[model samples]
Target: MFAVWGLIVLAGIFVVIRFTGLIDHMLPAGDPPNFTFAPETPVPQARNFFIACPPGRSPRTDRAMPSPSFDATAATLADVMIETAPAHGMQLMSGVPGGKPGRLYFLARTPVFHFPDWVEVEFILPEQGGDITFCLFAQSVYGLDDIQQNEKRTRAWLADIVGRMGPSG
Candidate 1:
């Protein structure tokens, strides 16, 4: 009887801990993010490598810093990313139908937990045939604490982009 009681208590504790986090990942983090422009949304930003993710959590944000830039047309860059993302093990979840020219907003699953993470990429076409600025935003579906997996995944994919696309900026 005591053993059974102990197991029930443990299970109850586990379920309770899972739901009590103040933030829920299913809700929008803020205004729909715009990747091509500087933050017009209220998504958290990192200051001097410190992010105020929450009032108490330490890692702050899962977003990458100094949004990467590329020297390619928005259409071309978006094509490159969509094609290459699967090779990097990011299974596509969803995106704009016909894939939104020169921009992409989609969700992918992490391998281990199949955790969902959102990534937005957009390119700003500079005048005079200048380099296009690649702005990217990624966040985990489980909110602020993704065990740093979100950041790691973003960096790895960005490096892959640089290697394959050879972004000039």
Candidate 2:
């Protein structure tokens, strides 16, 4: 009976910490599981994990197809991402403005959990001067499922970026 009581108390503390949003600070800095820019990056099977911008687009929500591939140059597209993502509440990580064909990273925070969700973006500029394209990968920082948060976020952010690019874009 005493052990049971102790277990209950521990569980209570865990709930409190999670609810108060205090657990995010104690975690070490790094990308979450299944967070990768490469297709070979393995995703662990679990309930709290989710990944967007996958190969072949099996999960359609994870995919974003912008007409004219965003209608901008490598630098302009990178600027769009840098300028627009934060408006949607994405906190930019390091390595932004990484030259042509920009490589940007960010963390997406949600009220659903205290852990961070990771988003990796790469802008591809044509060597011979063609349409600009980009790839984005987003996934939960923890758990097996993200309730489609990554997908939803990527879609919304893409729309916002396109909008920011304006009439020319």
Which candidate number would show the highest lDDT if scored against the true structure? 2
Q: How would you encode candidate 2's per-residue C-alpha lDDT over 13-126 as one tens digit per residue?
A: 998888776777765336433233454554445434333342442233323343236556788887778888887668777553332235677777775455677777666565
Question: Which candidate leads in TM-score?
Answer: 2
Model 2, residue pairs in steric clash: 46-144, 47-144, 47-145, 48-143, 48-144, 48-145, 49-143, 49-144, 49-145
Per-residue C-alpha lDDT of model 1 across residues 1-169, encoded as one tens digit per residue: 9999999998777566445532234333333233333333345542211111212222224344554566777777777777888865664434544445556665665663355666766555668877766555565655555666656666777778778878584
Q: In candidate 2, what residue range of length 10 has the lowest lDDT sum?
A: 58-67
Query: Against the true structure, candidate 1 has what lDDT?
Result: 0.56
List TM-score per model, in order. 0.59, 0.64
Poorly placed runs, candidate 1 (over 4 Å):
1-40, 44-63, 92-102
